[model samples]
Target: MTDFKYETVLSEIVEDGVRCITLNRPDRLNAMNRGLIDDVARAFEDANADQKTRAIIFTGAGKAFCAGDDRREHVHPTCEEEARDLVLAIQRSTYAIVLNHKPVVGAINGWAVGGGFEWAINCDFPIWGESARGFFPEVSLNLFVTGGVSSLLPVLVGLNTAREMLFLGERYDATQLQAMGVAWKTVSDPELMGTARSTARRLADLPPLSVRAMKRVLNATALTDLRRAMDLETEATIAGFMDPETTRRLKDF
Candidate 1:
């Protein structure tokens, strides 16, 4: 197979038609900075276009799957315009994952918070390690999750559980998430990637058109229509990020 044109993050095609995409900024705990955000979206888009790539497995390079938006990069210009642009970028990056047709799996090795949690939610399945943790702490930051979590969380763990997590900003360990039906499975930290890869390979072995059609059907149930849902999500995300309270909390972070 041809090599992937990767930069900012690392990506490679493994056996059994699995594409492994790793968030490479271990030094930052795999934080989603602006560059990594763009790269991740591009990686998924590329994988979607590649005929040989049947499934995608996403994971991080270090102690954490992703710590969320890098605090350093998020705290920018003390003005509204810059904040608007920042939010829009994040929304677009997130939309790429949600709209991708191929099966996507998240190998959560450690913490997945804020945007990181949203990223994981975008995946068709989330397989977590024993040490993995997931949380939506955006409420504490005066921000709401705009990364399709509002729609996805209820479906994963029920509306009551979703409200508790999003409204209270609580965090849950892999075991808890598994019990809540949010996680597909949990394995040892050392075996996280192996489990994810195996899952991806199994998925890739299935009939491609059937898999794609199933994904479309699943997504169809989530909204009045795909395009309408996307537009609503985009607008809500941009507005949430631009909220005065959210801006204040972001600056403080």
Candidate 2:
């Protein structure tokens, strides 16, 4: 929690040792630009390594938790090689949270669409606003899943449910996800940050060693080699991006 400044993310460590990082592109609904994605991954890595950071909270500055990648960022990669590298890097952004030692909480204030949905679900626990909704629009957009979601999501909500999410690209509200056990809690829009902060504080107050150990054990059992899955997903995603129809579709969107 040293003095870190990022162009698209804001980080703050509370007195209680909870580090809150806000995705700062409100006008774009916190869309994942290349800069924002890298900033997010770096922020989580730094917070995890910091001894003073007991727990981390991730939220957006405005209405949406994230709206997935900016169209420009997606269109920027000039060739298959560059697109592959870019997709892998984007996939790693969400892994920065799941692979971290300490607990990560997502404060989902609004839309978490496409890659945004991947980001929220990868958090150790997510507290979402009543207005918050998430969806995997990848299939429709000719994109593949990232964030190790294909492997991790099946473990959370079962194979069929995960398929329904990915294949059908359905939008899920806070209540539906809470019912499916994907969301830890869902509160009113105004109460979202407060509830997440309170939960993060409770976690930060716990024994740091025990908390870290618990998260490690959980990852060992349930989140093993998440990076590998992300790599595979990245390959598929880049292929999709390179498809001419997908390029046309993205441009139209």
Candidate 3:
């Protein structure tokens, strides 16, 4: 992990063979920009390949875990090719987390909106702070979600609940999400990182080979269409970007 460097992410080995990766754009509430998204993808890939890093604790730096895209400073693709590249780069972060060999523990400290909520779902264990909230704002923004959530959400909370979450874009508190089986546990803000670190420690202590095997087997059996769903979502999102209505909506937002 020491050999790797990132512009919008901070990686360091925590105790008990666990690596803690923090999203570093606190000024922007860690919103997903090109640099942050690329850094997250590379960071997870590096952690997956590092044998010494047994588990990963993923969290944000400030009040919000991630405010989704940096709407104010967001990049706009001028053409379909640029839109495809942007969408692919956004999807790559989710791939790194979901397909990583090592387990990822999410410390959802605050608002996990849109893409941030999708990333939280991508974690093997998502722990939320009591005050944290989550919701899908993609539909409202004239965009679609990435992160294979198109396949995973319905399975986690059922088809009806998933539709409500995605279509209505209402916020759900930490306790509510835990009850829906989307969050593993909810703790106070002060305990958020500690709980996540403890969870990572437990994972680190497990038999690595067995854990990895279980993850691969479970994903293979349960999420067989994950890649397809992601691909579809990417294409849909590209269409959203190319639509003039989306540009108008973004401007109004």
Candidate 1 RMSD computed on C-alpha atoms after optimal superposition onto the true structure = 2.2
lDDT string, candidate 1, 24-89, tens digits? 989898888889877888888888888988898989998999998788766553555765676667
lDDT (10s digit) by residue, model 3, range 1-253: 4456799999889775899989999999999898998899999999899888899999999889999889877888989999999989888988899976789999998899888898899999999999999999788879898989999999899999999999999899999999998998999999989899889999999999998998888888989999999999999999999998898888887
Give lDDT for model 3. Answer: 0.91
| Of 1 and 2, the candidate ranking higher by lDDT | 2
Model 3 regions more than 4 Å off: 1-3
Instruction: Name the best candidate (by TM-score).
Output: 3
Alpha-carbon RMSD, candidate 2: 1.6
Per-residue lDDT for 192 in model 3? 89
Q: Supply candidate 1's per-residue lDDT for 250.
A: 76
TM-score attained by model 2: 0.94
Q: Could you tell me every candidate's TM-score relative to the true structure? A: 0.90, 0.94, 0.97
Give all candidate RMSDs, comma-separated.
Answer: 2.2, 1.6, 1.1
| Candidate 2 residue lDDT tens string, 108-201 | 9889988888888888889989999999888887879898898888888998999999999888899999988789899999888888888999
Q: Candidate 2: where is the Cα deviation over 4 Å?
A: none
Model 2 alpha-carbon miss at residue 44, Å: 0.8
